[model samples]
Target: MAAPPEKKTLRIGVLYEHTQMTDLAGVDILGNMSTKSVNLVATLEPRVSALLPLSTPMEFLYISSTLEPSWTTPDMFVKPTHTYANAPRDLDIIMLGGPDPAAAHEDSITFLKKASKQTKWILTTCTGGMWLARAGVLDGKKATTNRMFVAKHAGEWFPKTEWLDQRWVVADGEFEGAQIWTSGGAGCGESYVSNTR
Candidate 1:
């Protein structure tokens, strides 16, 4: 038999919340070429098949001036979360997930350091990207976010990172103090691509 193709391993660190939205529609579902789609909640994302752990690791993190503790004990009791829990320090990838934006607010900067400090990629969706800026990983780098929020405020809040307003996905890179990726628009999430190659 012929030899099989080699599989590439990519560790993506995603930070998500409970109320945050997602983009899931496509050319057929949108009925238009510009419909921005997003799932209400996710971690690994259904699109990311073949990856271990179905539910994205969701943490009870807050992005604010004062750091707060996590309340993750409830997820184990809830079935909606698939009884999933957070990952240890030695996972292949780490993606933050949740459904609430306001609730994501906190002052804990250590989480970002611990998550993205030594991972292949620190990926985030929606407001989760906001946390990256606060973490200082995107400092002196470029990034983008969903158009739902005002650009002016987004730029002001994440001044260290460049605010990209393009209408497509933008991937800066994947490394410590090197690459920073951002989606141009949630609409383009359907045809998402990377700049790795």
Candidate 2:
């Protein structure tokens, strides 16, 4: 009998910040790609942590940005497994998200710009797209953010990229070394649901 080819393991990193829970959770959807071989690591800035609600008494636990932790709210809080400074440089995919466009802008740009150079794929949702734009990762790429927000403000921030309308998700071509996937608000998946019905 001939031997089968060995499967390649993918290292996936998801960026995290306070109040940016939705899109971070959305990153889990990527697990569908190959759960058995895909390793998902949530990355954060130095000295930063992700806080999430508790089941009893409404408490919160501060998880180390570089250690794997359990999640109290499966749908809301995703405990990080690494800090940006310590995350794997050979990540195959990187996901970016924040509660607002400006959150962690300056602190994350330097690291993001460097990581994007080696990452094979970049997936961003909502204002998370803004972080990639600010990092110049989206330059010369066609992408989209939350329509409500982009309709009024994205142009001022991403003048080099082409912003499109009338869609739930906009996929752009490879730039440098990464393929970019961006979507409207966190509710973008919902649009697919409506279309399917």
Candidate 3:
């Protein structure tokens, strides 16, 4: 019998804007559900999206239209690389965020398509959806943004996708779209439930 051909290693890229939007909210957000305060840690339940690789390494890539200071300061999950690394080749998964909302929307997509050949999974948070929509990723994928856009264009941009009014995390597309995840906007240096049913 003939032996099977060897499989190729999958590559993933996570590209985020240089700016990190500090979406504002208050600690008592639950009190004034309609209030979007600007000095509080919005309680957001971060949903983890698992990958499908057998043993591929996760690569975290960053991009900024502006000068984003290196975040070497440690907090929890990881320590800073403290150096520069190559793109596509290094990342197996891509996560994105910024100090501002428009940054994510303005710079995440075209860059993504340029590297889509190697990207296995593309994920974002909060207003990150705007970025994906610009990239045409959400052109036809079931996705959700925050209360703001959902009211304006969730159904319009992701025309090919099913836009749900309530869901903590949403995944659309199969295989090709596999691992594409989006979550609600975080407020005031933190994430919020924004999960209104």
Best by TM-score: 2
lDDT of 2: 0.57
Q: What digit string (tens of lDDT, one per residue) describes model 1 on residues 1-197?
A: 97645434333323333323343222122222111122322233665333323223223222222222223324322112211134333333443332233445453345655655555544444444555667676677766666554287668777787777654334443454433444434454444323222
Better of 1 and 2 by lDDT: 2
Those runs of model 2 whose alpha carbons end farther than 4 Å from true positions after fitting are 32-77, 168-177, 189-197
lDDT of 2 by residue, 1-197 (tens): 97645545556666665435665555444442342312222133322222111001111122224445423223455565666666665566666654456655364677678877776766677777777788887787787877776766777878876777644454543455456677777666323322211
Model 1 ranges off by over 4 Å = 1-16, 21-86, 89-102, 105-109, 168-179, 193-197
- By TM-score, the better pick of 1 and 2 is 2
The lDDT of model 3 is 0.43
Query: Once superposed on the true structure, which residue ranges of model 3 sit more than 4 Å away at CA?
Result: 1-14, 18-59, 65-86, 98-107, 156-161, 172-177, 187-197
lDDT of the candidates, in the order given: 0.42, 0.57, 0.43
Q: Which candidate gets the maximum lDDT versus the true structure? A: 2
Model 2: how far is 48 from its true place, Å? 39
**lDDT score, candidate 1:** 0.42
**Higher TM-score: candidate 2 or 3?**
2
Model 1 poorest 10 in a row by lDDT: 27-36
